[model samples]
Target: MTAPFPPSRPSPTTLIGGHVLVAGGLATGGLKYAADIEAEVVQVFVTNPRGWALTDGKPSEDTALRESPLPVFIHTPYLVNVGSPNAEVLEKSLGSIRHALRRGVEVGALGVVVHTGSSVTQSREDALRQIHDHLLPVLDEIPDDGPDLLLEPMAGQANMLCATVQDLGPYLETLEFHPRANVCLDTCHAFAAGHDLAAPGGVKAMMDALHAIAPGRLKLLHANDSKDPCGSGRDRHENIGAGLIGAAAFGELLGHPAAAGIPLCIETPGKVEGHRNDILLLKRLRDELA
Candidate 1:
């Protein structure tokens, strides 16, 4: 189905923002929260991030976000695991994705971020086949004007379907590389998955690998620092400069050609002040590189 409202594509510049809290609603609270952090782009969850229940967001809040100048993206619930071996889990995952996509159109969101899930108790081949069977139809239903389904590879956790940039090759292949099948590169996840973004040239190498794996598929970035060491397989997030990924790596990320024009949204720790500082630091890095 065609998206009733197609979001405008973001310009070719590094737009920095954070995942703003929406406890106060998107308009009454979320927009102000983003403003206080001076966010240039925004990521939000239309429904509870951890719950399976879908919500019809307040019309005023939806309208507020749709009309707002900043680019918007929606992150699906953490429970969504399309690659799961359980039938009930797979069904719920697909439903959640559809809900997020619908809400993305309602809010003029550019993309809907969904984690590349695990394949618990099943072989990798079986999980991929299941994903292809279920996910392809969802992708096929998304209209050209609808939000892109941005698959976020996780930290190198056990049984993860996609973690490294190279892994995205098969994952995208499973989805047939649909136009709307894009990627969201999270720095901490990449570091945990053993990309070593903190090392010299590491960020560039990762970007190069992504380009080689799925050219032009990167649509969003989660600019975060890893609380654990590279290859730790931990998903802990830290303030930009305070973690293992470090601030300099972000500078390299901003300078990289592949990252240009993509919106960078911080999922780092600390609510307001921490996010504000992270955004400022990234902006500084982006400016210095420019």
Candidate 2:
């Protein structure tokens, strides 16, 4: 163990990470499964792995999970496309959002993460309208104790509206989502989407942009590296500091003015050793760069 936490005063939380406990993808018991497999905390999909209709999970099941100091998070199903223009897709998307919020409560999760999907060639105004119309209502249904939602912008690919974090600005502004409606910036997605967070001022620029939109709404970070060039619009996630985005970028990310104390989650390849290596690397950066 990393020595009983060293008993220091808790610092103010920000975008950077501090001893992150990456949640494993749901292959079995969802969050409980990850918890059992040596996860400090975990994130899981509470539904049919690849379906629109979310499965109704029981709350008592979450109550029976193994005890730990780590907090759990829920990742909404990938089938949800909140930015879709088709009526059927739109309805399903909205329903999926509601289901994710509700399921998050059942599992005693900290929050749920939703991808800021594209508008599918629909007018930009209409796309924004759809988000304001369908998404905000789900946020309203959530009670104070319910798990809040975290909006994640995807890599900007052809036909996708939200390819960068900046693309989510309008959606965030239009929604009545809880104050906890935070951002989850994926390193690979952000880098591939456009923002180069590896240069000297790159991290500063990213922090500035993130702060400009939500101020303090950045909740979690999908700590990953990219395999393509900057602005490639590819979503390939490589091991930390090993791909297109160099190690210095992470140094900037882990040691940024804005990124100081957030739960940096790892969604990289491999399970035990992959996560272990990344976590140790991040910890080393925090120590050397912080």
Best by lDDT: 1
TM-score of 2: 0.84
Runs in model 1 lying further than 4 Å from the true structure:
1-13
Collision pairs in model 2: 16-259, 16-260, 156-163
Model 1 lDDT on a 0 to 1 scale = 0.90
User: Which residue pairs clash within candidate 1?
Assistant: none
Off by over 4 Å in 2: 1-39, 58-60, 176-180
lDDT of 2 by residue, 186-260 (tens): 888888888987666886687677776667687777788788888888998887878888777776776654555
* TM, every model: 0.95, 0.84
User: How high is the lDDT of residue 238 in model 2?
Assistant: 82
lDDT, candidate 1, 1-290, per-residue tens = 21121233223357899899987887668889999999999999888888899889888888999999999999999999988989899999999999999999888999999999999989999999999999989988887778999999999899999999989999999988888899999999999999989889999899888987887889999999988999998999999999988889998888777777888999988889989999999999888865
lDDT of 2 at 56: 65
Find the number of clashing residue pairs for candidate 1: 0
